[model samples]
Target: MAASDNTPATSGLHQQAVDLLHALTGRADAHFHPGQFEAIEALVENSRRALVVQRTGWGKSAVYFIASLLLRARGRGPTLIVSPLLALMRDQVAAASRAGVCAASISSANATEWSQVLGQLDRDEVDVLLISPERLNNARFREEQLPQLVNRMGLLVVDEAHCISDWGHDFRPDYRRIKDLIRQLPPTVPVLATTATANQRVVHDVQEQLGVGLVESGREPVMTLRGPLARASLRLGVLRLPSNTVRLAWLLEHLGSLEGSGIVYALTISAAEDTAHALREAGYNVEAYTGRTDPADRERLESALKDNQVKALVATSALGMGFDKPDLGFVVHMGAPSSPVAYYQQVGRAGRATERADVLLLPGMEDREIWEYFATASMPTEAKARAVLRELGEAQAPLSVGALEARVDIKRSPLNMLLRVLAVEGAVEQVQGGWQVTGAAWHYDAPRYQRIHQARINEQNAMLDYENKSTCRMQMLVEQLDDPQAAPCGRCDNCAGAWYPTHVSQQAAENATATLKRVGVEIDPRAQWPVGLQRLGVPLKGTIAPGERAAAGRAVARLTDLGWGNRLREIFHTDAQGAPVDQPVDQELGRACVEVLAQWAHDGWSGAGRPAGIVSMPSVHRPQLVQSLAMGLAGAGRLPYLGELALAPGHPGGAGGNGAYQLASVWQKFQITPQLQTALDNMNGAPVLLVDDLVDSRWSLTVAARELRLAGAAAVLPFVLASRG
Candidate 1:
């Protein structure tokens, strides 16, 4: 079957696809967008590999859905769609149902549906199957079900296909497995990869990956259908506010006036939560959506925004990609995204079906710092990769992530990502018990990673350029995405004069200031010691005895909090020598700490009496800051100031690493000095408030509290200026 076949059968198939399109949209006048029908024809008639690089609202779903039905009608097997987000899968499933395509999904979220979905697949009852990329590697699915599915799969659709490329803004390691999946699929099956956020680099990378095995089979190169990326409906702008409080005030003053319900994007979870809280306090109907948001709640929130029941959902990147709401009125970024392409993807959510919608970027001073942190965290280093490989190679049995976390210094999230990367490279395998070495040779690929790192830096700079540039915001984004037809969108704030109000009422500013100033974030104490600590030469395992455990603690603020976070970041800011500045507590922060203590005491300290005295942890870096905070609190509360704990000589001082390593670094590192012992004795076994500058792993707090409890204090109440999550 060739694209130029044009037989009566091909003509009938095209007519059927057109009819299905009308059924899908419930509009008799509904017609295909520019590349939609061609993409469908390529897949259905020619069974060709196609990459559709269209804008967000460009009906990429229609092309695949129509092709799937056309292929199934020809006695082909079920269509297999590897979708990224669960929300996207839900939307696709519902849309399939409306279009008379029986669709089913199997994901971690729906274990109960697995058997039923499998049954439907075996019976040829399911017309389309949606799954996450990670699902392809599930042991049972990969070993048992995937082979059969691959043999029978009529059409393979990779939604959000940008994720398959390392150059993609939101690349996931599991998405690389799709390349292997493409190779495994029958040569006759048509493959469709779709994304709205791929630049030329990403597009070429995706095209190459999609062509895997096809060219060897003498199949033609993938047909790429790219369209102009500009969206006429979006009215873009950048509003530079001085601080987080002013931005919140701006939203308070102007959010209600926005045309309809939409998203308010934040860079981090804490920022999203804080912004949503402020908006809700201002009497706006909004909720915070983040990775931390519950799955059920995410579905509910998506529905709420879709139905226009809420003014907005203040969300992190979790709400992005494949979230469909055609008439979303606005998208307001609390801070600019690290990439112009990513910003375009998120803001593209607005005005899909409507005549007009607003998109605004409220660039923040902290955005770069946040971007840098994530950029580094996401990329695997050569040392860490080799460390993981060495650990797996040495293990006799497969090592679970918990075991690997203790053996390797990487945390669980990054460790999982690293394992996936290794597995993809044929250096590791995830078996039933855990992960094991695959005995395959692996190289560092340093040059490639360096190139990617530089690319990310360039993207960050482009985003900053987007914020500062006086030219068309939309044009800058399209150009960043390599849209050759990128022309000035006449609707943006620059082309047209500012359409949004910048005024913040004095009352609103005061209210926002109050919200940001409010403090007191609970620091939940670590209950159990990390597994495999014994292997780390630390004889700690299982739950810490309740008697030895520090009571749930308090931090004046999280290091990421909007209000106190800014101040705490400055206090903990590193000096030119790359060491924490050993400064005393400032009056403003001191008062805030006192207010936190007052509230904590009022809220009841785990049903204990007030703290009898204060003791400071031995901080190798910020000792002065810790001591000042402890002494200030002791003096304010009229309690005795117990002497500080002594740090053992030759103790490891740096922070970071996983739980086991962090605990091992500080274990037995703090000793109760004789003077501190005497001070604790003088307190008559009362609870002691143990103060520290910051809590990262909580190991320092836990280890210090254990020493205090063992050294005569009745209870240890850990207090910190900030908690780094």
Candidate 2:
């Protein structure tokens, strides 16, 4: 493409920046926002590092895009963007394309395209390359591709830059690696970091990290542009529904009238899915977007919402951050987020390119439960971190995650989180096969994590305050971010009155109860054994042989489910006094379990005859819970109750871990009672019902079923009260 006739002849950098900004925005008359021009000038003319903490829709992407164009024109290399999510990268790539910039991404969603993207980069045909933080730890990428790219990178842009700070509401251990990365970049290269949800503390930490390895040059001071975060387009409100029942009913009654296509946020994936299902049944064209959503399906759903073909998206935090739709109409929270900053960020997604978008929060008593669970999930434990280091140090070669799990007792998710934390701290380095110790002395930084934990407590309290505050809701939120510009907005319920209705009809309430009362969740069977099982002395490999695997099992609901999760948590949660005592199964949930089996039977489940007998899995903590469930099911279905499966004297409990470790822990560990074997032998070929409290890794069920099948049971149908994801 040729330059415009209006392109000024041999101009200064400022004129060039202005021209590029117009091209970037596709508006010849487009000019920069107050701080946008300054940021561009800092990056392009002065080659200064900068951090921009402005609201969403403030053209943070434009700052880097326009700056990249100007620098590349001067023969600088491609800008490397460390993006956090696929949705963000997709939007940025599209946004850069509209600006006539060539951009490509390498992420899990496009693993097949990495070589092509690398080829493009090799040819210098890419203007920007977007990669996840996890990519930085890829040994091959770091040792081979990264050094070359880092040497020539014209500018480094950290989108969602607040994540670089541990103090940020959504702290990611992977993002901590950017500090090491920044320290390696040449001082002459400019860096720009951008986020929509940082306060003073987060801004200061990010700014300090952005200044890493930049001590040599006489670059300008790191510019910090923080504008007032109050978005006047949002009309905020809080609806304190008495229960999840009333909340779902209110949505059933009022969702259609809310506004144009938008997002309805739920705190958990289960809630998001259940809410979407209920809303769809009520004739709303809604869909659920969660971490579990298929990548292709997420793309499809996002497109549907963008095209207004869907009413609203029911989504978890998975849908948050840099999901761009200029005309996204509103955002509704079914339950409050853990932090006001997080809440602000989700609500910020709405009203970016619209006027007067509705933002409402319906707080729940269960919100605190969810908060407590997730707040401590990523905090590093000294014992776990030390165990990983020891494992890696003692290994002759790098151990893959599966191999590492077999050696260590930690579950996969927490283990992976610890690995990332160790990687960030320079204690462990991911290698070709798996991971290795770096020999770097690492401390657990208890104070920092403790501060983060307490900060979460403070944030939770602030969220509650926002819900019940007599002052302006919007002001309270902005203030929670420590924004100096916070002020009362007359649009909130407290400021004026609620712009939303508070009433749900009895019919809608009944519909919600019907939806919530519905039970049964699919237990995804383990199709393949964990890798390196043979190394762990278990012969299993690829697929679990068809006959030995349990049939698609049945559970009333996941512990995360909105319908039964509440009661299950009550049964599972350790109270202030101590651990949950073993209690009898609730009659309603027991009936729900019966309902699940009944439906399974209707769906042609009983091949060898409706379960010949019921057997309970042995439980050290909740033996009574298991017994009560087995007895109730046996009574309701008129089946004989076989006593609990026997365990060796010192047999360990069914704690969750990866497949190989769990299987190794329980392999041949259960002893079939002589009475049970006699009972099974007498049946001559009959299916048996196996019951348990919960299923996580499912190795116990698998091993137990293998034992039962070996002991003459024709088929084993595994049932559980709850499944943990």
Candidate 3:
């Protein structure tokens, strides 16, 4: 076990590692796995620049470490390891140190120490360097210092090589830029890249992007692990929530039922806090983590989780980015993730050692909104970002924020933001001296754009397929990933009979039919009858009768407030004292109107045809209308969930506006909280009954009713709000 123990100095591929370990640590035998030896031999036999891919628990790190050791042993040069995660780099350095290797890392956590370490490397006192791509990308740091450092590097190893490819599950533009940095290196210096998982596309991209010949050893044609090992160590579970509050209640219950070190990934910081509170109320140990938490406190919480002092952690994605826990028992997704890859990675964190672990998905309707939001959300144009990067390449040295802003023709704030993102992508490096553009092989051109765009289209098409899927959920999963050969997974919702093909197919068809009916507007049951009304008009809810026309008209009136109508009173109705007044609209109608309004709000009121009054709208129009209407009311302080709303100017019926209105009063006629009651108490105007086109779930309507009654409104009434029969 001594450093001088007999581990024979090997020849050929492993010679560099033996020499480096012997010289740096005086260790004759640093245990190396056979897989590592195979990878090193492949790299030596093939090309200097190569890629090594394997599973996470496998010793992928040892492959490059041994190579670096070998090169240093031969007096080649210092080895540089560019890592994606700072924490992982720290762990590597710690492990190397424990092995008596003079290794150090450069990351945000140890900036000052990095400078000292780099100085030591310059003095020829250090052998190995571990650093994050962000640190290496810093132009000021690179120009003033890194060039000298890299010039001495015997090898440049890109850990997490999958990041180099945009097609990889987690793509960083900075990672795409590393090839240019390598081009600046000495021709004789070798480059080794390693990753845990890379599909064929990823492997191809990594090679092309890095401009290096590949050494693909251990690329098994058949999966080596079959049977029980093929099954995920983490068991995936799903829970359906009736409402947001119910989601909190359920989380609390589950936490109380299952006690151990775990994580609850919630959608929002607020949700995390509320859920943590509920869990604590239920008498369980819990703490919530969010972006707002202080860095020191965050570290403390992580440490506590590691120590098993904290029973559970309720947090957003912000909490777990770089942190790794090998013994984690579970990672509960309290809400649906925006994408499957994100879900997969988060769940993968648990069961690291093939120990049994639980991965839970607490599904809720709110998640549908989250998914829809992602589907429609706008992203920065790839061209715009790429063009900014191109300009960076022209610079002789690192450019300052002010200078880069002018060159990029973007505001300083946005330019800096993009620079950070690009830094993360490994496309550019910022040092104390200036900005340096990297990744020359991955150019911003038409062909690249076409590829990226095609990928986007593929993703969109896949989304549509997922929504329209009629097969088993597991089958759908395999289909989405194009892994048709995947043996039938018997643990998924489909295989477990939680989601049956027949049931889902019927549900999807019914859902589609309802959507069509809502958008088309059929007012009577007869209209819904077979061939009764050819091409149903604006979506009908149940049976719209002549008597409900007034309610419908009343609901339509608020549309203008939601920016749905023009030439209609923007401020409809006044208080009893004859002052200009705006009362809380009914929740159902208000929600529908707000959603429609948001659409027009984006289109500048022209997209909706600049209507002066009620216009036939689709059922899809109703949900967005409600959200917009709610936002407007909330902004005006007229739709308080807790506090009263201030009446519009020149309002009557009260001394300083009617008592503040509760949001509940506007619908159900009850005040749920002081904050909401305060809002309800403030509105001085006559109560406007906001009727919705449909109350499919009736949950929103119920909340609306409670708020309306709590505000002490004169009267609160429901209109034509019906769930799908």
Candidate 4:
């Protein structure tokens, strides 16, 4: 990612003292030192698009804000500030408003107020407009009237520009079309882009994406921010737990002891709810924040957090982005978060103004598995021009996300996100009722997609490989971004030996093996279970009835051309020497199934050993049963059903192990999230398996198996590792 030659600069603009002061005091400009000011000054005077690779503490905001106001004062019309966080828009608008700059931000906070702002903009009553990309795609805003208003606008300032790059730590597809929007803007309006973090490639992408002018300030802000730069004074605590309940208990105890404003980051809505409930039961005022939260309740929670009415906030990543509460004493991660960007932003929620904050990563095996799950499951696609065009073609009117979700069968959130991308690409026209096709063809272009996709993959791979590097982690990141630092960052986990190289290797190996690797066990989709089905020879068509017998068996019959049976026999068979077969599972389906098995061992293992009970499963989804078995083996270091199964005398483990090795008949249940799916793949392609939800004689397993198979899984096995019935 590189900056374009067309970026706008405020080389000779005379900034009003009021605007300059406002920009200076804003949080974006907070904690600026003298040398950083010199860098900012240079960027202000430069006309070319500049790369200000300043560290975290250095007021990176001043570089863009000052430039924006100065450019405006110099008669550059209105500056359209593209911010990453909706919350930040308020802060920016508030600061600008204080400076006598007519500023308005379009966000979920003021959804109805947008029309008023638009009316004002039409009348030329506003100067700087701040908004989130989400806001930009609002059907009401993207209508013909709004695009006309935008055409009347002047400059474009992209804050947190790193989001535009797939290679960036925080990748948001909504930010993809920012470059196009700028290109569509009044041609003379210059683009000013700013971000707290960006590697060389990310910088390149930002420039290319936004069409920014070239200006490079060779300074690091994170390194220049005050004294012990890493906020080393903050007590970094790692609490390892075996279960969510235990983690909740620890959090409750700490919240009681701390008795101060804090944040607890949860991996899911359920976790947040459970944790909040537990905290409330323990007599603490708390609330959880997620996309699912009602707007009013969400507002109340933010207000509570700000006013310190709530002692703690149990939230997801939604709590990040522009949340500026300076008195937080602790930030607790109730679950593991993927990537440093997410971790930094969430932890950075606390410790505003460089205070002594306690940053705790309370990670359990499940939590870690979930984080790993999201990272591995995320599949980055190329910029598909046709997908964009198809969206634009089908859209007749402006469509909101709700409408889009109704049109498509996908979940509302991701579907809305994809719509956002299409909107940004100018492929679809945003309208009041539904989207209108703008007559642009966004067909898939492999070459163009490859460029962006490959760059992103390279960047992530660099970070993944960083754990194995002998150099400091911080240094490795900096150098990967082409910022070659001679000295190691003494404050990071690497410097303190908190992140041991050995640990990284172990984790990577486990992750790789548990993933959909060729070397792992393949799930056979054709392997049918005889328990709940009418007959073994009959293909399951309609549904299974009640009171069926026999056990769940996964079928690999689909890959007849691939000879999946041979691969399975090779995998299950022992050599003449009585050892497990040595031949590698070569077929795709076999490999995929094996990978699922591996995922179960890594991610699904509960560490409680095999659950005790008569494990029963629906006959259809037998692969899930294997997953439970593998997980039990990994967690408890042995099979739980050893003494329970009535098997042949010479059954593989039956010769020596007790009947407990065989799982008692219990139906297995499942729910899949992209995050959970990633964990399953990481655990060896074992999908998320729940044992309690399964009832005797049900079609759920059958449905689950069909869905998994549809999702490219070689098989879906549902075996009971335990039974409560």
Candidate 5:
């Protein structure tokens, strides 16, 4: 537009913005927070870059929506917001609609509506458009749509802007693309970045990236407005529960007595589901919200909680960040999060628009273990990154993740993250089919990754200190976030005294114990070989012939389950040398094994009649553990124990990787032993029970069962102690 158009607004323009705010909020009493007006003014009037770091309920959305309306009214183009999550976009869309803003999202979830949304954008019908940072990596979106949008865009907003910084608690490699997006935008276009949880380091990092580097983009210096990170309405407390059983019992005892609709955060998806199940059985209206939840069901669940139709949603961190429910009465953490910053963000969800709300942390003993798993999962390994690079470098055509997995040895989540990082570094490009090497020069920044990793460790230790604090928890949290105005709230448990009941009913504890003691989750068989395995030289593709596939398997428990997960995790814990050294299955676990078999039979997932024989998959790390479990089951069930499947010289086990690579790693490693073949031949086609210690990828079970069936076993019913997701 013109220089005059980007100048400060007149009184009439400011009044029109105020009127638009009222129309958007539908409340005559609606007023801006301390810096909200300044943020809006900077974006709408001066076309300036601004960073607003306020608390969760500080009306950051209002600032953007109002600014978008004012800009659009002045004949500027629509606002384009780069949001971090789908939940945030959904809430923002609804909030925008409330203000008469014709907002729409072009996201992975709304592919069918993209053309319509694009048409709306072209016709100047859309006032706001929300999209994920990952969308910028889309070939078509980056090449076509984004360039046009950037040319006419009135304002740029980056929600959860802290994610752009590697120093941030939730540093997403995808958000790094925002820097490129910001660089591509018109120099005169207004820009706003907002986040609830960013320390000084993160703030400066984000600001530098936002200013298009420390050199300032030849534009006005970015305006930073960071407020105190404190929530007066939330009463924080850390309750050190003795065990998971005690924690569940405490919830059973105290949840109903707590205030309005709220959320219960669990560290893992299974924990959330199990806690939700336990709470439901205790007659509390609750539901589970996790990455595993279906998109439509998640919407329903979120709506149900928001409308107060459900008491709470037992959720992982997936339910956090842009979910808006004003009077949410309480926020409880089933286990302490890895960082205080993350905890603050979660507890901030409660008491957003209330005088007082309860926020408790029912800290568990298993918290550290769970923390370690996630911490390791997020960091990219040099070996794995180079493996991905080497594989991509050799591929003749663009390959999807599944195809990449066949060639590379990395898990799906980490692999996806690495691809994004590589894309940002110009080492790779995401295309229509999948990803391709861009043939761009790339260097491994070991020092940078190490620095970030060390920062995370420091954060983790700080969180542990927060859990152990005798002083004000709220004060500690704020200081950790680097809030200059940090102060004790006099509302937390440490500030006042224990306001929560410490007593748990004996019956509640018994019921919790009973529920937790229950085990045996069905493990679904892999019906088809992973795609592109043939390219990986495994020579396998398409459906596993029905006859060759293992029968639907059974496990004592998932390694992530709320029940046997704790023990199984400890048993399978990796050593200081960074390799797993397994422990033998004891008699106590033997009893649990019996229970699993009984439950399996009771459920009839396993065919009628006990297994005629037993075969165990040889373990690279835990032979004794696998042997003992198989032998215990064999003796208990009174079935003949066949020999274990022998490794055909070079099977390295599944190790850790995606399905196709895992399959390739184990495909040629196992063979039916002569002794087992003779045992199977003698059984005259009677079903045999195959046992293993861990079921990570299920490739071992599939391959082992295939060998057994080839040796004439009628059916191979695979069993494992733990199923790792």
Candidate 6:
């Protein structure tokens, strides 16, 4: 059906949709946005698949909710919406209730309500049901509930449809399953996919996926209704401060002046938490939202921001996508995201229902380094994929992730991601017990992965260009998103003048510096040995012996810390020759280490008293740095300096492996040198501080501490310059 097909029947449907929209928004005069009514008409009247690419506040929800109510009044079943975020689902469910559409959602956060939701669905009392894409692979749901839901689905809605394409910035492997679900849907079911972000490539890919099995069935191709992506309400600008402290100081001086409560996005969780702490210390009502935040706390934080109970929520990407706040007044970025498209999507969250909102980016020098780390992390390696496949093929039964971790070198998070990719490629299947090979031959898509990796690099460079671009910032973003309506908005700092304050008070700068300089990150000791270590020839299982455990330790700062992180990153940074640089601890860092030690002493150790001596871990990469830090601390404290631990002969010194393999590689790798033993004997059972340049897995510290404890030391307290959290 053509968008221009507005017959008398379509007109009547439009009138009803407008009425439903009014009810949804609590406005008697509410009307559909430019493309909303057409998309709704295509879905409701023609039962055609449609993809609506509109701006954030374009009433995509209104289109779907109104269509669902219309379908239900015509005796169609409940709409099945595969929403990406819990925040999105909550908002949709509440909105559905307001529109008098009975909606229920089944998500991991609401497992207790599953039975109730299922009952409602069975009783045909639910007009719309929302769920996460991951739920589609749940064994019980896939086998029992999903089939029934598919059979009776009045309409299929894929929220955040860009995730269906790998070209999308925020693609999820589980979203690939949506294509199969769409293929399985009945021919009569109208499908609607909605998103506010997607480049031309991503849009085409999504179109192909959404059109699965429909073309062969003689149904119309998916109709795409894309509107202009530019937002007239956002005044965008880039503010380049010299250091993290100064940038934070700017926020301290100016955050309150923003129109309303908004978000400050950081690239890393540590940055977000650190910024939130600084703001709170300065008496700002703020909270941190990150991937590590508890689900309940996340809900509370979202509500707090929505109700304007808090001034702002300092967050990482965890707060992006589908978080709705119509009157959000400002959006500040502590660091630029890698892609212009992603940046646009996040900033679009602001100025949605307001006349004007400020969007500022404080580009960090460390942003590229952080971007490279994530880019590499998200890409799957052929060697690791093959290793996973070989292990599963040889296994007698399905293997749980833990068991697979024991056999493969990949870490847990990356391993889970690789498995999802494999499952999507049809090489593996997740079952009740665990994951199993499906006997399907799989080829590593080297070219495709390479293209994606290069695409990320290009995007990162494009982001840099965005920061430096003197033309319209919004136009650059829309063009990057392939929005044809891209043009100078005449409102950004480039088009107009900088609308934000750039001044930072001396007092605020001092406070920010103090916040950054504050040190001591606690390192939790490994309480229990990693499971299945016995399979790797290590006889460790269950709880580690208390006598062998190191006391909870401390690091001067995390490698990702917004303050000292840059300084420490320089210390551990690799040289041009691609080898780790070894250097002595600078006076500044040494003083910081002393500060950490002083705080630890004041706080009191958990299982030991003040250190009587310092012993350094043998570092293959940074021996000089490790020795310098330990000896310097020993001298400053006027304590005996115990010699460093010796590496066992033929010990393999390397990194990058899972817990079991990491433990195996370092098992018995550290030996108590004769010099260290002599120093320990003189300490008379006093606690010794074990120093290392960096701590990644903590397995090395655990093993070295065990050696020290067995060698007559009463306790070992681990300390490091930085932690790789």
Q: Rate the local accuracy (lDDT) of all candidates.
A: 0.89, 0.85, 0.52, 0.50, 0.86, 0.91
Q: What is candidate 6's lDDT per residue for 545-587, written digit by digit as tens?
A: 9889899999999999989999999998898999999999999
Q: For residue 204, what is the lDDT in candidate 1?
A: 96
Sort order, lDDT high to low: 6, 1, 5, 2, 3, 4
Worst 10-residue lDDT window for candidate 5 reads 1-10
RMSD for all candidates, in order, please.
2.7, 3.4, 17.0, 14.7, 3.7, 2.2
Q: State the lDDT of candidate 1 residue by residue for 1-725, as single tens digits.
A: 01223323446766788789889998876767767888888898888999999998888998888888888889999999999999999999999898999999999999998999999999999999999999976778899989989989999999999999999899988898899988887788999999999999999999988999876788899999999999988999998999989988999999989998999999999999989998899899899999999999999999999998999999999999879999999999998889998898899999889889999989888898899999999999989999999998999999999999989888888888999999988899888999999898999899999999999999999998888888888899999989999998888888998889988889999999999999998888778999999987899899998878888889998888888888889988998989778889989999999899999989998665688988998777887898899999988889889789999988766665988888888888999999999988888899999999898889999999999989888888899999887
Evaluation by lDDT, superior candidate among 1 and 5? 1
Could you tell me the TM-score of candidate 1?
0.97
Please give the lDDT score at residue 264 for candidate 2: 95
> What lDDT would candidate 5 get against the real structure?
0.86
Model 2 weakest lDDT span, ten residues long:
1-10
What residue runs in model 4 are displaced by over 4 Å at the alpha carbon?
Answer: 1-19, 22-48, 51-57, 62-65, 138-154, 185-188, 212-237, 241-246, 256-260, 372-409, 422-619, 622-725
As for TM-score, the candidate ahead, 1 or 5, is 1
lDDT measured at residue 713 in model 6 versus the true structure, 0 to 100: 84
Write candidate 3's Cα lDDT for 1-725 as tens digits. 12333344566555665554444344566554335555565443442566665444445665666666555666777778888875566557765665456788777878778768867887877767887776655656667767886677777888877778766656666675577677677656677787654556777787775553222433312111101112245555555644444445445445544535878888666557656765675576779888777766877888788788888888887764356676777777766665453455456566665456666676645554455554333233566677777777877777766445435435344455567666665577676665777765443355764675566556545533433444443344334333425455566554564421111233333432332222111112111111111122212233423222211112232211111211123233245786554343455444554554444335543221222211111122344433344345445333332222222343222111001111111222222455534444565422334334443323333334434544454333333322221
Clashing pairs in 6: none
- List of clashing residue pairs for candidate 1: none
TM-score of each: 0.97, 0.94, 0.57, 0.58, 0.95, 0.97
